[model samples]
Target: MCLSFHSFRKLIASVLFLTFFFTGCKNSEKRTVKTEEITFIKEGELSIYKPGTDVPVLNLNIELAETDYETQTGLMYRTSMKENEAMLFIFDDVAMHSFYMKNTEFPLDILFIKEDMTIGSFQENAQPLDEGSLSSKVPVQYVLEVNAGIVAEKGLSIGDSISFQKL
Candidate 1:
């Protein structure tokens, strides 16, 4: 069948419109994947332990993961985290490393930890996107994650120390 120029232009426009509509919806869907509310305690206090340390009490909600899988997965796929809840990623040895918000819907404050439980560096209010890497300025063995901006709100800063304890 032979088509007139006007009809062909109309068909092209329709195809472009549908393509944009579907693409927008797909992007929105991906954004919500990690936006669901997570069931974590907010009103309770938890302790953090600095392995092989003799310092005083180090009260923190996040705890170190003792297993390899837990350390590797860290906090991936978490939709939401409570204000008082956190995740501490531990490594067997101090090394250069980085983290990203891949698959993480909410923004976070990432604290790179040294072997002595001191914060090497921290990145606050990190954006969620694939292939975004937040790295430590120095070699570190532990990392802590909390709700975005909590670090500054709590008056925590570089050179301020952190320690952990067994619960």
Candidate 2:
């Protein structure tokens, strides 16, 4: 069918408007992004030892957080951690480091270890999802995160040492 110039312009404008309207509606639809629950993967085995003792006080299957990304994301999305599991963050330089419980679902015991493999300091029973800074008062080369109350239950103390083997 033949149409006047003004009629054709109106038809084109109407089509354009409807196209944009539908596209906008489609774009505005609510979208839920499914996030997979993170699970614990054992990368090593670590033992906490009493001072000057050959026997270990506690042994754990450890997940090492060595890379920058791994260290930064340490145990953030996990729902729960088993009693025998832990995350050990290894840093290249021995320095005072601080941690927070951001995005973590469960409470934790954070142990700071010095270059000599001795526990330098610790923060026990850190609440979940807390943004408060948990500090290692002394310079440390490693940080160990375990289920909350582990330190107290195991009687872990400053000067306690650790040894680990990668699996």
Candidate 3:
């Protein structure tokens, strides 16, 4: 077929435009995936205590999940946590530690804890779905997760202490 230069250029441009448009749409759709829930552990009781004031009067409700599944799920789907609410993650021993908010829906404050019950370090304002690893500044035996702003509200400091019991 014989065509003019202008017509040929127009045809090529149309082809290119459609190619780019469909490809762009497909890629965008892939990016807009619906996030699903990941259950880490089974249901159990967890209790939190202020590190070591020698007074065990006040305690908090924690979902105890020592197994891989329970610990992995953690508190990813919960919409709200109470003012006195906390999650105590227990490990077999104190070791180098890190955490990420992959499927989590709420912002959190993470407290890396030592065997002595002293605060190893604190990651305040942990963003939801953030994959960045919040590493412990020191080796930690346990990790306490609370609502993002709760740490400052409670006047919790890096050197502040914490403790827990499996109920």
User: Whole-model Cα lDDT per candidate?
Assistant: 0.73, 0.96, 0.75
Winner on TM-score between 1 and 3 is 3
Model 3, position 107: C-alpha lDDT score: 92
What are the per-residue Cα lDDT tens digits for candidate 1 across 15-123? Answer: 9999999999999888854456445433333444344445423355764554887666566777777776788777888998798887777888988888977878999
- Candidate 2, which ten residues in sequence have the lowest lDDT sum? 25-34
Off by over 4 Å in 2: 1-32
For candidate 3, the 10 contiguous residues with the lowest summed lDDT are 39-48
- Quote the lDDT for 18 in model 3: 100
| Model 2 C-alpha lDDT per residue in residues 1-167, reported as the tens digit of each score | 99999999999999999999999888878566879989889999999999889999999999999999999999999899999999999999999999999999999999999999999999999999999999999999999999999998989999999999999
Q: What is the clash count for each candidate, in the order shown? A: 5, 0, 5
> Order of candidates by lDDT, top first?
2, 3, 1
Q: In model 3, how large is the Cα lDDT of residue 102?
A: 85
Candidate No. with top TM-score = 2
Q: Cα lDDT for residue 167, model 2?
A: 92
Better candidate number, 1 or 2, judged by lDDT: 2
